[model samples]
Target: MKVLQINSTVNSGSTGRIAEDIGHFLLQQGHESYVAYGHGNRPSSSRLFKVGNEWDRRMHGLKSRLFDHHGLGSVKATKNFIRQVEVLQPDLIHLHNIHGYYMNIHGLFEFLGAAGIPVVWTLHDCWPFTGHCTYFDRYACDKWQQECHHCPNIHGYPQSWLIDNSRSNYRVKNQIFNAVRVMTIVTPSQWLANHVKQSFLKTYPVEVIHNGVNTDVFKPLDAPGAGGRYALNAQNYVLGVANVWDTRKGLGDFIRLRGKLDASIALLLVGLTRQQTDGLPKGITGVPRTESVEDLASLYAGAGAFVNPTYIDNFPTTNLEALACGTPVVTYNTGGSPEAVEKGVGYVVEKGDVDGLALAVRRVLVQGAAFRVNCRLKAENFYDKNDRLQDYLALYKRLCAVASHQTVYDGLQN
Candidate 1:
């Protein structure tokens, strides 16, 4: 079977790596796998297809910023990609993060609807259904249920400064997206699945597949020098990590939590910009993002507890990574962040509760290495990369088999 996966990146961020992992799994099962990506030059095991050029993305961004028409740009790029897809004739198409200023959604979905290819779309966020923002919980907006207009998050991601075209965008998306006949929607969190069921896309089947982590690389490390490498005092620190740091990620809450914590318990925040790191308050160590998974594992292993104060997320892989490293996690009760923490493994505090976060971190620090075994067990049982990848392979086989049977049945009827 041939499977083509389309995403915004390849072998890079969480979603990119997931596409790579699934491609690798398919190849191992003796299936041809291809990845078509819009950005990032990361090497992948699967056959690679570059979707669009930088200029295409720039134009798309300009269109979005000026006209609030994000997915409508890149018409030529989408048409060219459609030609390539027709030539490949893959048995299935898997979609991820298609809103990343690359593909023209109208053209792409029109092709999908006409071609009648089996599709399994993994929604990494709510952008596909919503008109403006990838997430709307922060603003407490529910307009996506019926219609999206006068978007509250108009200035958010896929940011539009000049116009609010959400009403028309929503109607157009509803018409185009629902045109596809054979499709399944997969969300990384049940919270997101519930939201999907409430949206216009509720007619399609929705599945919850929590994101997984590489346990072998993320497991407990014996690196004693890890502390000194990051200028950490010892294993007496609470760690916070994010791909990008901002107020939405609860960066300010971490700053407040530091004052409530004991001076002996150091605070280390990873994945900060150099400028952000330099401007950090005292008693908090800021480290820039590290590409090496081993380095992250070392940091996770050496820390007493992992804290994620994010106000918005969809089953963050950081929580699983920390658990795989035998480090307990304390996260906010926002989105699927708390789902990674099982009882006795960690704690889930209410969102923006600096005192609650501090108390949870202190509790974990007091318990020390005692929670390590439980944390590792939880990760292995629920978030193992191998198991999760296999789930995708199984889904692929089922979808392809059904499609093949339907094709045969149609031939018989004719």
Candidate 2:
């Protein structure tokens, strides 16, 4: 069977790693799989569409969805892709965060639905069902519940001056998505799966498939040098990672907890600007982001506990990484993040429970050595890399079977 996977990006971070993992796994299994989307133009046995080097051009390409819900752009580009896909002729189309700057959503999904193809949409966020926002909780708005007339984040990323473009997006997406025969929704956590049920996309079957981490690169490290490199003794630190200072990720809550921490403790953060670092309280240290998985694994092993003060999350990779490195986690009870922490792995505090977070940190850092082992055990039980990948493979096959069976039934009735 042939498979086509689409995502906005396949590089730079965990999202990329995820796309790569699935593609490589399928390749080894002797199944033909290809990837589509921007930022991953690498010559894989599976890359169906190779986008050019122009970032702005790639972004502008997505605007074609607004023109007509049936295939974006001139016949030339659409024909080229359609021709390529015809040659590949995949049995299944798996989507992951396809809104970035990759292939045309309206064009591609419309085609897939019309062909009565099976579709497995692995939602990394709540983008597919919503009008526009990838993450609306950051804006604290619920216009998505009705119609997205006046968007709260118009001036934000993927800016649109036109009002109610969300309504159009919703219309186009619904028209196309409804035509899909087998739409399997895959969320990273049960918390997100539950949220999917509340959205306009509740019709499709939803499954929780926790993202897995490669433990070979993320296992516990014995080097005390990483501790000194970050200016700490063994087990003398805490770590946090995020793309930016998003309110939903709860940066402010972490800052408040930082203020109450002991002067001896240091909160090291990656993926923040110098200004963000300077704005942090006296004891918190800011480390530049490391793109290497091995480096991050060492960072986790060196830290006492990974602290996630995020107000909301689907399922944070930091929680998994900390556990993979034999480090505990202290995260909020909001969203699916707390579910990942589970029992014996770490502490789960209510949103803004700075006191509880700080206490969890001290317990793991100064005295909870045995408790940290529980974190590693939890990773093996729930997030083992092989198990997570296998789940996707099974889901893909199941979706394909359902899609095929539906096609035969409809053909017979006609």
The residue ranges of model 2 lying beyond 4 angstroms of the native Cα positions read 40-48, 52-80, 138-146, 155-157, 161-164, 245-248, 274-282, 406-414
lDDT of candidate 1 over 1-414, digit per residue (tens): 899999999988788888998999899989999999999998899999998899999999999999999899999999999999999999999999898889999899999999889999999888988888899999999999999999998998989997999999999888999998789999989889999999999999998877888898899866652667767865788899888899889999999998999888889898999999988889999998877788888888899999999999988999999999999999999998888887888999999889999888889988867899999999999999999888887888888888888889989999
Residue 250 accuracy (lDDT) in model 1: 93
- Measured by TM-score, the strongest candidate is 1
lDDT of 2 at 241: 83
Each candidate's number of clashing pairs is 0, 2
TM-score of 2: 0.87
lDDT of 2 by residue, 83-140 (tens): 6777777898888876654456666766776777788888887667666666677677
Error of 2 at 62 (Å): 10
| Candidate 1: stretches off by over 4 Å | none
TM match of model 1 to true structure: 0.97
Q: Return the lDDT, model 2, position 50.
A: 54
Which candidate wins on lDDT?
1
